[model samples]
Target: MLKKYKDDQEFYSLVGIKPQTFYKMLEILKIAESKQKYYGGRKNKIVIEGRLLMTL
Candidate 1:
């Protein structure tokens, strides 16, 4: 299992990505949600926004 990361910087460190690269990755991956598509991909929640979310 991976440790939960609270901030973008920490997440960047864990994933070994540069700031620019991380933003690019987020865009390309389509996991970081927009308001409209949030419900459509409910099961695909990620820790991108500092929420202590987990799947039950």
Candidate 2:
């Protein structure tokens, strides 16, 4: 679904943020996720980018 948006304007219109900003936010999430210890629970099946998009 992410790959479907090729134009910058279209992507921004759908997501309400610049693609660069999205990637930056994703990087931050990845770092934060990496530092966290695993707890006993169902793990997320969705990729980080999808989760961020859902939040947006």
TM-scores for the candidates: 0.33, 0.80
- lDDT at 49, model 2: 86
Which tens-of-lDDT digit does each residue in 1-56 have in candidate 2?
Answer: 36777788999999999999998999999988876635445567998889999999
Which candidate number would show the highest TM-score if scored against the true structure?
Answer: 2
Model 1 lDDT at residue 50: 29
Displacement of the residue 55 alpha carbon in candidate 2, Å: 0.4
Q: Lowest lDDT 10-mer window, candidate 2?
A: 34-43
Quick one: best lDDT, which candidate? 2
lDDT of 1 by residue, 1-56 (tens): 34556876987666666556655655644554565476675654455422322211
lDDT of 1 at 39: 62
